[model samples]
Each structure stands twice: as C-alpha cells, then as structure tokens.
Target: MLEAVGLSARESAVYQALLTRPGADAARIAGDCGLAEAEVGAVLLRLVQDGLVVQSGRPTRYEATAPDVALGKLIGRQEQRLSAARLEMQRLTQMFRDAGAPGDAGQVEVVSGASAVSARVNRVYEAAHRQVRAFDRPPYMQRLGENLPLQQRRQREGVAFRTIYSRDALALPGRFQQDIELSCASGEQARVRPSLPTKLIMADESMAVVPMAMGEAFAETAYVIRSSALLAALSALFEHEWSRGVPLVAGPRRSSEQLDQPDEKTRALLGLLAGGLTDEAIARALGWSARTTQRRIAALHKELGVSTRFQAGAAARDRGWL
Candidate 1:
C-alpha cells in the first residue's frame, strides 16, 4: 500500500518502524526493522529529506511525521504527476497519429473478447475529462447500471454526460425507471430515438469505442478509435442523432395528490409517447397498471384537448410539456 505512494519495501518497513518507535536512533530503528545500522542511517536520511521523518539531537533521533499529513501529501503529489503523465500521453498519441504512414493501423485498435471490450469501455469513461457522449442501445457488454456510480462521480466532478437511448433500449423491462430515469435524475442529459445505427461512446472528442457488430457476440469485438478523422466523424454522427432525439427528462417524484396536475411523471409520459413506446412499455416504466396507464393517457388527452395520442404528444410539445 505504501509502495503505491512512492515508498519501496525497505522504505515502508523503515517508516513503519519509525512510526511505531518515534524518537529512536538509527541503530534502534535498524534493530526494530531488521535492517543494518548503516542501511537504517541511509534510509533515515532519505526519509528526512522526503519530509516523512525528522532528525534532531547529536546522536540523530528520527521521528516519523503524522501519516495522515505525510502520506496524504505524498499521495497528492503522485496524483499530480499521474495527471501530468496522462496529458503527455495524449500529446504523444496525437503526434503519433499525425505521423502515421498512409495505411498505418495505430489510430483504430481492435479489442477482442467480451472482457477486453468491457474493460476498454470502462477505461474510456474513466479517462474522460470534459464530456462524454454516447449512443446507448441493446446487447450491453456489461450489466445494467454497472457504470452508474462512476457516471455519478464524474458528474459531481463537473464532467458532462449526454446519452441518446434507443426506444427499444428504454422499453427493456425495468430499464427506463431503474437505469435511464435514475441516471437522468443524477444530472445525465438523456434523449431517446426510435432506433440508432450503432452503439458508441466518445470521450472528450479524443477517443471512441464502437462494437464491431450487434449480433449475439456483439461484445466479443470492438474498435477502440483514437484521435483521427474517423473519431471526428463519429462525434458528428452523435450530434446528428442527438438533434433528432426527443428529450427524456426524469423529474422529482411528486405525491399522488399532485397526479391531477401536470407534473414530471406526465412529462415523462409525453416523452415516452413521443419515443413511440407502447402502452405496456410506458406502464412498466411508470410502475402503473394497464388500466391506470390508459386512464392517465385519457386524462392527458382531455387536458391537452387532443383526441388522438399523437395529437396529445404534439400538443404537449407545443405547450413545452415534453
């Protein structure tokens, strides 16, 4: 554990010994840590230089600094260095792509197998800084809601997420309420479309991951696209689909008394209606029975003064309800 923060095995052992027996001389530390006196003295000098230990008195007693303060600072510095390294890596990747030969295959890497594809997907999301744009559909590589916590953390860190879900994806049993709606409630900007050409995820306009196929083995192969014209085209494709998508908003839940009024659930109903979901799909998402769902639709139609469901959807949009 200490090794991750830049301490070697010997250094960690010496530090632990010092921490347990503060104000000990190098000889005592050596005996406690099972190291030679000379080695302990050298380690003590390095520790003092690193601010992990303080040496004082003629005989040179070494005292360990508070681990919370010292280790926390060390970990912070390591994180800064890692951040810098990531930036440099991006710079080098760009340079490499720019210098690629005519038919070089460096920009697009083929990641094989389900586990590899899933791991690459996670890495792409983890590395995103500014924004994440995705076209979400069925045949998921990982379990549903697996990335929810990570996405929420990124949102809290000010990273923006925009996802366009296919209508079929939203219509999956329990998917809308359990995953999509919950994500929208947690700061994800969501939209739904009747269908999507493909599933894709792009991070900060720098990288994208697209499955090679959408069959039963869709997760077995994927193309990890680095910075290139293809990546730019994929980003443009996302924008096009995003423009055509209907906004899917999940509002705060209201009391049953508020059901008579136009509320979030109503807006969600309008969105689902616009997305072309059937009555059953809508009912499942809103946790309502078929009868209740029809009653609500009837009431919505009456309120909107529209005889047809399509007209109701259009009217709601006209009135800015969806």
Candidate 2:
C-alpha cells in the first residue's frame, strides 16, 4: 500500500509500524523493523518531517500521528501541492502545445520498478484527454490489452488514436487480426510497423513511456517515463512510423456512406496495402488489373500527401477518413 500510493517501502513499513505501536521509541522501532537503532532514529526523523511521526520528551521519543489525521494531513498537503503544480503545468503546457514543439523537453520523470511502472502507465492513459498510442509487440498486447478498454471514452469526445503493431503480430493470424479489426471498427488507428520496443503513450506531446530494459523475453523490471524531451522523441517516432502504417476500415462513424455504397472494397484494399502488401497482391485480391489498382493507390497517396500507400492509409484511418 505504501509503494502503491507512491511511498517508499521503508517509509511505508515504518509508518505502519508506528501506527500499530502508537508510541514506540526509536530502539523499539528498530527492533520491530529489523533496523539499526540509528537507522530507526533517522527514519523517525523523516517521518516527523512528513508529519506522520511526532517527537516528544527531552530524549525524543517518537509517536505515530493518528492514522486518519496523519493520512488526511498528508493527502491535503499533497493535494495543495499538486493543484499548484498542475496550474503551473497548465500554463507551461499551453505554451508547449502552441509552440509547435521546440525540439525535446528539458525535464524527465523516471518511475522505476516493474509493477509500479506498469500501474503508472495505466494511470497515464486513464488521465489522458486526447488519444492513446500503443507500441504493442507480442504478448504485451495480449496481456495489456486485457486491461484496456477497446475504445476509450475520451475517443467518443474526439480523442484521435493511432496504434502501431509489428509485422510479426500477424503471426497470431486471424484471432489477433480480429481484435485489430475490432479496434479499427470502433475508433482506433491500427497499423503494422517493423521491430519495435515496448512503448506506451497518451496522445501527442502529453506523455511518452518506454521500458527501462528491452530483453528478448521480458525484462525483470521496467520504468515509466514522463518527460517533455522523451515525449517529443516518441511523438516524432510515432508519426514517422504512423506515416508508414497501413489503413483499415474504421468504425461505422468514420466510414458511413449509406447502405449500398459501403466503400468496403476500397477500404479493404487500403487495409492490405497499409499492412505493406504490394499493389499486385492488392489487385489480385480486389480482382482488378494491377495497373488500375496502382494508379488509384498512387492517387490516394498523393491526396494524403504521403509517399507510400501505407502511410496514406494510416494517416487516413487516424483522421477517421478511411
């Protein structure tokens, strides 16, 4: 609970022990927590500073603040500070968001430990007002996707999203593609990218998260980072890859051309090309001449200002056009 609420392990243990004992002195606290007498004294001092522990008597015995009172005080102080910081952030965020991005940012937040980092990652998305970008690679998708809603409620309010999946993700065959298909039909942008690292995000320039370590299997731990520079780099990266992603037919809302004129064939061909399929394959599947298909594909790319049909499709889908 200590770590979950953003407390250090030692800090939480000491605080909880304090609550149980009520008025344990330094020596007793040391014995209970298996810490040295001096260490106990130091921890108590920190607790006092945090308003969780109070010092009394000439020799300086320590007492735990009432749990409710102590927690309330801590929460209140944190809230005040957070409010102030958020206001300041809002001012700065306005400037940053308006500046068209001035390269990378100067600040970085490195959240360590795997479980805590993962939890924080979920927090970032939960707090996002814009779109959430997922750099999904393999089992991470299967596992993490379970925790994520298929379409975030904010998307209903106009939060645009773009997700990049690796080519190998197709190895999952129909099942995974079905999920991707489902995502597209809901309100998400999904495209295939090449080899990728574990990255998570919430909107453009809001937050950028990546694992601290990238092992072939799973890294024992990960870090969730939130910083301006990191977010900018990740944004550029997402855009670059998104520029190379394919298109899929979007939800009924993004692609509703009445009953008889569904635009299904064109959209399906776009999906295949966005997945990096060739014009020849697209033509074969669409039952059209390769020349005609290529001409239409080129026309689409030109209209979208994307060099490749894949980019055109990804961009189109992201904007709810395809």
Candidate 3:
C-alpha cells in the first residue's frame, strides 16, 4: 500500500518506526524495524530529503512527518504521473491505429475455427469498456448460457449491453426464458427482430467480431474488425436495426383487469407479437401451450378492440402497453 505512493519497502518500514517512536535516533529505529544502523541512517536521510521525515537535535533524532500531509502529496504526485501515462497511451494507441494500411490485414483479421472464434469473441467482450452491441442469431459456437455470467459481470461493472435477438435465436428450446429473459433481468437491454442479416458483436466502437457465414458454417470463420470505416458502418447498421426492433421486457407475470393497463405478461406478449414471433415460438417463450397462446392473443385483440394482429399491435402501442 505504501509502495503505491512511491515509497520503498525499507523506507516505509523506517517511516512507520519513526511514526511510532518520534524523535528516535537511527539506532533506535534500526532496532525497532529490524534494520542495521547504517541502513536506517541512509533511509532516514532519503526520507528527510523527500520531506517524509524531519531531523532535529544535535544527536540527529528523526521524526516521521504527518502521514496525512506527506502521503497525500505522494499520492497526488503518483496520480498526476498516472494521468500523464494514460494520455500518452491513448496517443500511441491512436497512432498505431492510423498506421494500419488501407485494406490491410490489420484492419480486419480473419480467425478460423470454432475455438479460435470463441476465443476472439471472449476477448472482444472483455475489452469492452463503455458499451457492447450485438446481433444475436442462430448457429452459436458456444452453448446458450456460456456468455451469461460474463455479460452480467460486465453490466455490473457499468458496461452497457444491447442485444438484438433474431426470432430464430429465441425459438431455440428454452432460450427465451433461460437465456434472454435472464439476461434482461441482469441489466441487458434486449430487443428482438424477425431476422438478422448476420451475427455481430461490437465493443465500444473500437472493435467488432462478425461471423463470415450463417447457419451450419457460422463461427467456422470470423472477421475481427478493428477501428476502421467498416466498423463505423457496421455500428450504424446496428443502430438502424435496433431502431426497428421491438424491446424485450422481463418482469413478474401479474393479472390485470383492464386492457389499457396491461400487466407484465401482457407487455411481454405484445413485445413478442410485435417482434414477429410465430404462435408456437411465443408459446415456447411464455411457457404456454399453443391453444392457450392463441386464446390469449384473441383476448388481447378483443380487449384492444382490434380484429387483426397488426391492428392489435398498433392499438397496444397507442395504449403504451408495448
């Protein structure tokens, strides 16, 4: 801890000893701190020079300076140095990025094989500081729950996550309740689209990982995109898709008497419906049977005074239930 403030271990020990025994000669400090008299004298001289120790009296006894004043100054200096280093690091990073040749391999790296892609994905997520944007679809390299803990930990650490799931992705067995809803509960801002053109994960506009193929070949090969025009375009595309996607809300199911005041269940139903999920997919997601799902949809439509699904969705949106 003291070293963090720029004190060596020997200096810290000597200073602590002096603090405990004010106006102690070098011999006394040496005995108390288990150092030789000569070593203690050298340390005391350095400490006095650094204003961490004061020497007085003809015998040259030493007293530790007030820790609050001394250590506070040291900490402040260390912080300044660290801030300067961070600025230099950022400058160097920008230079490195700019040094990449146009259409060079550095701009976009191709990683092949499922294991390599998985490693790259994890690395990208770990590097995310501010935000993570992802397009979730089928043909996953890892299992459904594999990335949940990582995502949750990042969210807890103030990293924002936005994911848009394809309908097919949510249609996976137990995916909706087990993975999607659980993620939403852990502070992930989730949305769903009927389909996605590709699978992508972008971290803080600095880097992105995109699968080269969909379906069976997904994740067999991936492109790791660094800071480039293509990355910016990809980010813009995500924004466009996100603007059109329907949000997924996770909350406890409750009963509501009025249609205008829909409960969590109704809101979820509306979201799934508006996201273009099939009746069977919605049933699977909500843990309802096909018949029950259809019945609820019909009731929702009647309550909203709409005959068709589209009209019901529009009415729900107007009522602020979606």
Candidate with top TM-score is 1
Tens digits of per-residue lDDT for model 2, 67-112? 7887877777778888999999978856654433223445455665
Compared with the true structure, all predictions reach lDDT values of 0.84, 0.64, 0.85
Q: Please list all clashing residue pairs in model 3, or write none if there are none.
A: none
Number of backbone collisions per candidate, in order? 0, 2, 0
Which candidate number maximizes lDDT? 3
- The sequence of per-residue lDDT tens digits that candidate 3 reaches over residues 270-314 is 878888889999998888999999999999988999998899878
lDDT of 1 at 161: 95
TM-score of every candidate: 0.66, 0.46, 0.64
lDDT-sorted candidate list, best first: 3, 1, 2
Candidate 1, 208-277: lDDT as tens digits: 8899998888889999887788888998999999999988867556577655446777877887888888
Candidate 1 lDDT score relative to the true structure: 0.84
The deviation in Å at residue 260 for candidate 1 is 11
Candidate 1 root-mean-square deviation in Å:
6.3
lDDT of 3: 0.85
